[model samples]
Target: MEKKADQVSVWCIVSMASIPLVMTLGNSMLIPVLPILEDKVGISSFQSSMIITSYSVAAIFLIPVAGYLSDRFGRKKVILPSLILALIGGLIAGFASWKMDDPFTMIIIGRVIQGIGAAGAMPIVLPLVGDLYQDDEEKASSCLGIIETSNTFGKVLSPILGSIFAAFLWFLPFFSISALSLISIVLIFFFVKVPKEKDEPVKFKEFFNNTKKVFKAEGKWLYTVFLNGVLVMLILFSMLFFLSENLEKVHDIKGIKKGFVLAIPLLLLCTASFISGRKIKGDIKTIRLVMLSCLAVMSIAVAFVGFTNKKIILLLAVTSIVGIAIGALLPALDAIITENIEKELRGTVTSFYSSARFIGVAAGPPIMSIVMKNFLNGSYIVAGVLGVILLFIVFKFIKENEIGNQTEKA
Candidate 1:
C-alpha cells in the first residue's frame, strides 16, 4: 500500500506539472504570431493586441471564483472542466482565423473563453501541488520549482514554435495551443487522484464569509508580501512589452532576429529559475536576502536598458538580470506564502495571488505601450523605479515566520 501511494505521488507531480506547461505554452505560443494575425484578420494593431488582453481580462474576473470552487469542490473537478473550456476557446480562435474573413470578433470571443478556462487551470494547480506534498517544505518547494521551470520553458520555446508555424499558416498557433490543452485534459483525467475533502459543502455566501475571515486573520505583512509578488510580475511584463516593441520598431529588428533578441532574457530567466530553485533554502530571512539581491540586480538591468543605445547587447544583458531576479522571486514567493498561510484556506489565498498576477500580466503591455508612446524616454526609467519600490516594500513590510507544516505525502 505504501509503495502504491508513492507511485501515486509521482503521478500527481507529473500531472500537476502538465498544468503549467499547457498554460505557459499556450500563452507564449501567440507572442510571435501577433503580426501575422494583424494582416490575416484585417484588424487594427490595438484590436490585434486585444487577442492577448481578452484572455487576461477574463482571467482576472474568473480566477478568484475558480480558486474558491477548487477549494470547495476538488482540484480535478475544476481542472477537467477548465481544460474542455480551453479546447473550445482554442477551436473557436483557430476556426475564426482560418475560415472567416472577418475573424477579429470571433477570435476575441474565443480568447475570452480561453482566459476564463485558464483561470480554472493555472491558479488551482499550485495549491494542488501544495496539497500533494503537504508535510515536506523542501519537497513542496521542489515541486513548485519544477512547475515554474516548465512555465519558463514554455515561454522560452513559444516564440520558436510560433515562428515555425507562422511560416506555414497564421492560424496554426491557436491550433497548437488547443492541442496542448487537449493533452493536459487527458493527463489530468488519467493521473490526478487527490482525495476529496470530507467537510460539508459550504454555500457561496458562507464561502465568501470564510474568505473574508481569512483575509482578516492574515497579518498585514503577509498581504504586503503578496502584493510585492504581484508588483514583480507587473514590472517584469511591462518591461517585456516595452522591450519587444523597442526591438521591433525602434531598432528595425523583425522576424527571427527580433524573436532571437526577445528570447535572450527568457533564456536567462529560465536559467535563473532553475538555479534559484536548487539553491534557495531555510527561513524567511534567507528568502528575503535572495529576493532583495535579485531585485537590486533587476533594477540595474532595467536602468541599463533605459540608458543604452546598443539595443542588442543591452537587451540581452538586461533580460538576463531581470530573468535571474524573477526566477528567484517566483518560487520564493510561493514557498513563503505556502509556509505562512493556514492549510484550510491555502487555495483561496493563492487565488488572490493569481488574480494579482493576472492583473499585472493584463495591465503590463497596454500600460507600458501607453508610456512608451507618450514618454518614450522614460519608460524603462518607470520600470526601474517600480522595481525599487517593490524592493522597499519587501524589506520593510515582509516578516520572517517559521516555515509551516508540510503537505502530507500521498
Candidate 2:
C-alpha cells in the first residue's frame, strides 16, 4: 500500500522522471541552436522565436483537455500515445531540417505537432506521480521534487546539448527530440506501473460538476498556486533569456562558454528544488513556510538585481539567489497541489497547473526581449513586484491543513 522507493522500483521513478526531462529538452534544447537555424534557413530572429513559441502555444491550449482525458481514460493511456506523437513530430522536424531547401515552415509545423503531443506528456506526469505514493505523502513529495528537478536539470542542460548537437549537424537537435522521447516511451512502457482505478470513469457532465465543486472548495489556494506557477516560470525563463542575450552581447561570451555561464542560476535552482523536496516531505506547515520564504527571498533578490548595474558577476550572483528561491518554491507548491487535491481531480488540476507553467514559457522570452531591451531595469522591478504579490497571496490564501490525512477517492 505504501509505494516507497523500495516497494516501487526506482526504475519506475526514473521512467516517470524522464517525461519531464525529455519534454524540457525537446523544446529548450533548440534555444542555443536558433541562431544556427536563422543562418541556415535565412529566417529572421522573430521568425526563429516562433519555432520555440509554436510548441508551447500548442501545448498550452491542449493541456487541460489532455488532463481531463487522462483522468477519464488513464494517465498511461494518454501518456503513451502522446509520447509517440511527440516522437513523430521530432522526426518530421529532423527530416525537414536535413532534407528540405525551405525547411522553416515544416519545422514550425513539426513543432506545433510536437507541442500538441507535449500537452499530454509532462502535464500528465504530475498526476501520475501523485497517484504513485498516494498513501505515502513523504515519498510522493520526494518523487514530485525529483520530477521538478529533472525538469530544471533539463533547462540547465538544454543550451549545452543544443550546441553540442549542432556542432555535429544543425538538424541533430531536432532528431534528438525523437531520441529523448523514445527513451521516455520505452521506460514508461516497461517500468512505470500505474495502479488501477476501481471507479468507473465519470461521465463528462458529472466530471465537470465535480471539478467545479473542487474549485468551489479549494479555489483560493488553488488559484494562488496556479498564479505562482505562472509567475515563477515566466520570471525564471525571462531571466534566463535576458542572461543568455547579455552573456553574448555585453560580456562577449558565446557558444559553450555562454552555455556554462547561463547554467549557473539554473544549477542553483535544480539543487534548491532537490533539497526543498526532501525537507518539506508533506509537512503542511513546512510547505507554507517554504513557499513564503522562497517568495520573500525571490522578491528581495530580484529587487536587488533591479538596483544593481548590468555587471555580469553581480547579475549572476543575484539571479542565482532568485533561482534557488524559485527552485525551492516549486517542490513546495507541487506537493501542496498534488497532496491536497482529491485523487479523481488530481489529473485535471495538475494539468491546469502545467498549462500555467507553459503559458509562462511561451511568453517569457518575447516578453523579456521587449522589456529588457526597451524598459531597461524595469523588467527586474516588475518581476520583483510580482514576486511580492505572490508572497502576499500565499500567506493570505493558503490555509493550514493536514495534507497527509486527506481523504482519497477515485
Q: Tell me, by lDDT, which candidate is best.
A: 2
Name the lDDT value of residue 144 in candidate 1.
Answer: 77
Give lDDT tens digits, candidate 1, residues 78-160. 98999889889999999998898888898889988999989999988878877767666677777777777777777777767
lDDT of each: 0.74, 0.86
Question: lDDT, candidate 1, residue 316?
Answer: 71
Global lDDT of model 1 = 0.74
Worst 10 residues of 1 by lDDT: 401-410
Where's the lowest-lDDT run of ten residues in candidate 2?
401-410
Which residues of candidate 1, in runs, are more than 4 Å off?
1-8, 202-206, 402-410
List ranges where model 2 is wrong by over 4 Å: 2-7, 304-309, 402-410
> Per-residue lDDT for 53 in model 1?
76
